[model samples]
Target chain A: MNDQTLFSIFFSAMVVNNFTLALFLGLCPFMGVSARVETALRMGLANIFVLTLTSLAAWFLNTYVLENAPYLRIISFIIVVASLVQIVEMVVKKIAPVLFRQLGIFLPLMTTNCAIFGLAIFQTNRGYDFMQGIVFAIGAGLGLTLALVLMASIRETSELSDIPAIAKGTGLTLIIAGSLSLAFMGFAGLL
Target chain B: MRTTTPAEDFVRGIWKENPVLIQMLGLCPALAVTNTLKNALAMSAATFFVLTCSSVLISSVKSLIPKEVRISSYILVIATFVTLADMLLQAYAPVQHKELGAFIALIVVNCMILGRQEAFSSRNTVYRSLLDAIGVGIGFTIALVMMGGFREILGIGTLFDIPLFGPNFEPWVVMVLPAGGFLMLGFIILGLGVFEQRKKSREAAAA
Candidate 1:
């Protein structure tokens, strides 16, 4: 259990192996929701909540239920994620309609966000205990939020600049993302 | 509603409406597993199989699925085929399977597969859906190959491990790294945009 301390795991997942900039997980939303900082923050925060919850659920599910049937991993993980998002959406709508209105569309989409799915598969692969898995999830979430907010701010600023026609929409975004990723690579030896 | 010809529907995904480069459907594999030509081809083959088969299956049974549970059912269908593809790869091409790892399973979450199911497969006939999937799948494969080609040639100084640039070439290590994927894809998209614009302007000038 003490093979890797909690702080190192957190730092590695959050900074060293960032879900978006480094691993390229959840890139669809990273590129899509990042156009506006407000929506990006909302989406990032929502993902943190969803990813943390899913990680916990997935840890238990893998430990107890799906350990025996390795083949069902894909279907089970996706179904669990989908159902969890649905549950979270309903609960949010009933309890906090404001949050739901802000987050409703992104919730269902999280079902397909590779980060959540990747988080599930990754934790199991790493064989992290419950506590470690939670830390990792939180770290990944924070990393995702960090990447999204940064990209959103940059895109917001880029809108004011005169960009060439060839690299306008997606092209410009990719180049910026690539540059951001390269910058984040500086955290390689932090841990 | 305007109906496009079947040939156009099939050809569009190859270039005009490429799922990877144009519509940007599934960018994960476009960046993740495309470091090598072999892995890229395997990934494309897996996606092609899953997309085409799932589209046919979903379209054939679209009427039976209630609207309320369509997404869940579509996911279920996609996951099953992804697993089948995963197993087939593991059995036959173990090296690629190991290399691909979570990505093969990640295919279930590929927006392209699910997008086709939700947008085209569920609405169109089975034949049309199959053709559309094949088109998009080919486009995805081609784009991935191009990305892989550039990465392998520059990043590793080889294409599919064939000595392309010879012994004197110094491979650009960044090209195979994650950052390189983004940079290469960005430039490719830009190049495609430039090509399209020039073609359109040339046509207008001739006219």
Candidate 2:
């Protein structure tokens, strides 16, 4: 396990193994919430914060508490992520109202984002230690952020293109995403 | 809000409120599992089983659960059923299970299942919830099979491993890949949109 270098994991997770484009982790928000660039950026940041905490807590529990009963991993990990998101939501609301209004509205939905859940599940399956798990989470979060921001930028411009009437909303976004997914495939050789 | 008929609840999920094509929920498995017909069918069956079983179970127990912990309870129920389905597939059909890999467990995070439990099962009667679950399950399965058929036919010139096209036909490799999944889904949405609009305009002109 240690043979795989940290830089490789970070780079692969961030680009070659993106959660949305490459792995199809969080397509709902990748499509639904990516209407504007600012909102997408906020959602990405919020996901990074929550995902880091989730990876930390999930790794701790998996290593120490639920070491024997691997079957209970999913139920326990979900509770951990959900509760963490709730805490982050409230804390963000009280400490920074402006930030809250910008990103807080998207926190609750992040619970079911699948990318966060996928992060914990992947790190667990990969058997990453503490420091390694955090690094992987950061990479995954940044990967998600990059995908979201890029999709938002394209969709924002999509409005200007003289798109066919039938392919106005999601149809057009998906076609563009397909192209992006193809482009991301070029990073496959980097590893 | 207008009260819906029991039959309406059962029927709407297939198309009008279809989870994948219309609402855009559960896109992960839709794209990942549709490369081949068998995997698509297996994934769809597992999802349908979990969604329908959990919907009924959650609905029946909805009253006993407190509001504060309802969401957690829902997760527990959904995860338990997903595990059961995963185990069943692994034991009986190891090949499909291997093909599905982590996506089976990832079903726990699918917004459609959780969304249905929160939006429908948590409030409705068990029978009604069951109807809604079956409807959505069938709808999701139909979408999977549709996309899988499209990809399989184009990618390999075969459906369900049976040769449909002769040696002259050259398969488009991209259709079997992840990129093709997105493009196929996009074109389907576009076709549906165009069909719906044309029908609307025709009716308007006649009226």
Candidate 3:
């Protein structure tokens, strides 16, 4: 287990096995919110924050609480994530009103992002120690951010080009994502 | 607030309001496990089970759930059914279960199921909610199968593991990769768009 260094885990999650492009974890926001670079960056930041929190909660639960009752993992994770998002929403609203306004619906929607939940489950399954899990979460979050920003920037430019009617909207975005995924596949050689 | 008949509710989701294609509610599993037809079918079946069960349960108990905590309650109910689906798949089809992995658990967060509860089930009668859930479930299944069929046939020159192409056929290995899922769905949606556009123009010409 310790044979795998933290940097490798981080690198693998960020590029080699990106949560969005490769694993298909958080495609919702990847498609939905990638229309604007600014929104995508903010969404990515919120995701990283939430994902890190979820990793901590999941590690604590797996190590101490869920040792015997493995079946409760799914139910418990969902509840924890949902409440965590709620708390995050409240805290953000209280501390940074401007950022809260910008994040708006996406923050609440983060609870259902699947990427966060996927991270928690993946971390537990990998049996990473606390530090490793944190690094993994940050790496996955950055990967998602990278994919989102790249897609958003591309979409921003594509908005200017005259595209065929049939291939507009989601159809076009998905094809772009495919090409991006193919490009990211090149990163697999890094390891 | 026009009323929709039971038949309309049932038929609507299959095409017009398709949870996957039209509304784009559940794309995670649609893209993740669709590398093979078997995984697609299994994943769709699990989603269908959870969707229908949770819709029925939520609609029946709608009045009992307070508005303040309804979302949480709905999620809890959905999670329970998802848990059951996860265990059943693990026991009956361990191989596919292993292939699908975190996705089955992730189904609990599938916006499609929870979306149905919040949008339709919480207000509609139990019978209508049942119809809606089944319709949406079938719609979701159709999209996944379309994706699965396309990928499996092209990626491996087979359908359901049965060879369709001669040995000489060169498979487009990319079709089975993660990229293929996105490309196939993109093309599928584009095809639908063209079909819709042609239909509208023809209808205008006839008129």
Candidate 4:
């Protein structure tokens, strides 16, 4: 049982290797869903909820089931995460309909979003215990949210500018993201 | 039911409305894994297997999927095939398996596969869906191979590790890096735009 170190984990999640800008784990939503700032925030928050819970769930399952039954871990984890996504979608719809509407298709899409699953596998890779996994999830979720919100705001502004027709939507977005990735590389050796 | 001929179904994936370059689906794996000809071929084959199987299964079971819970159903179907691919890669091709790593499992979430199953397969017949999958799969493979060829030759000065360049050649290290992936994709998109423009002019002249 490795004792959780808060500083290192936070650093690792935030700077040492950011999920979106650095690792490129979840670029689909970063590009597809970032058309509006409001939608981006909602997606970011949804990610936070799912990422946090997935981490806790994955950690518990890994400790109890996967450690003993290594063969079953991958299948079991997906099953658990899949059902949990359904439940979360339901709970959000019932309790927070407005936010749910804001999230729309992205809510269920989170179930398969590589970032959440990546978090699960990464936590396992880093050998974080339950508590550490939760913290890592929260940090990673916040980082994802931050990047999403920032990109959305910038993109909103970018759309208003007179840009070339071909490089308007995805083309410019990819270039901007590439530059953002280069910027994120600055933090590589910090950890 | 208007039966879509099998030949048309298969041909669509080859050019008309190709998934990777034209539709711009599944760029993550297309760019990330295509560093060498061997890797691109391996990734393409794996994708083809998973795609063909999922299309067949999803189309066959499309009617059973409830409208309200269709996405979940689609994901489950996709995930099962992704697992099968993951295990196959692990068992048969350990090196490719290690290189593809999380990306293989991430295939379950690949918008291309899921997008097709939801968009094309769910509504279409089995034969048409099979064609759509194959078309998209081929399109994806072609894009990967092209990107892999450029990156391999320029980045390492070698095509499939055969050392195409002489000793004096200095490989552009960036071509193999993540930045290079984006750069190559950017130029590819630009080239397509140019081709589209030329084709439009030629059509105008014909008219």
DockQ of candidate 1 compared with the true complex = 0.80
Q: What is candidate 1's lDDT per residue for B1-207, written digit by digit as tens?
A: 439877887998998889998899899888998888888999999999999999999999999999999999999999999999999999999999999988898898899899989989888888888889999999999999999889888899987788887789998998888899999999998998899899999999999
What is the lDDT for B107 in model 2?
93
Q: Which sequence of candidate numbers ranks them by TM-score, best first?
A: 3, 2, 1, 4
Which whole-number lDDT from 0 to 100 does residue B206 have in model 1?
Answer: 100
In candidate 4, what are the lDDT values of residues B19-91, reduced to their tens digit? 7777777777777787778888888888888888999898998888899888777777777777788888899
Each candidate's TM vs. the true structure?
0.96, 0.96, 0.98, 0.89
Error of 3 at A45 (Å): 0.8
Best by DockQ: 3
Model 2, B12-45: lDDT tens per residue? 9999999999998899999988999999999999
Q: Which of the CAPRI classes, incorrect, acceptable, medium or high, describes model 1?
A: medium
lDDT of 2 by residue, A28-92 (tens): 77887798898899888888888899999988998899889988888888888888988998888
Model 2 chain A TM-score equals 0.95
Cα lDDT over the full model 3: 0.93
User: Model 2 has how many clashing residue pairs?
Assistant: 0
Per-residue lDDT of candidate 4, residues A74-151 (tens digit): 566677778888899999999999888877777877766778877887787668887788889988988888779888
Chain A only: TM-score per candidate = 0.93, 0.95, 0.96, 0.93
As for DockQ, the candidate ahead, 3 or 4, is 3
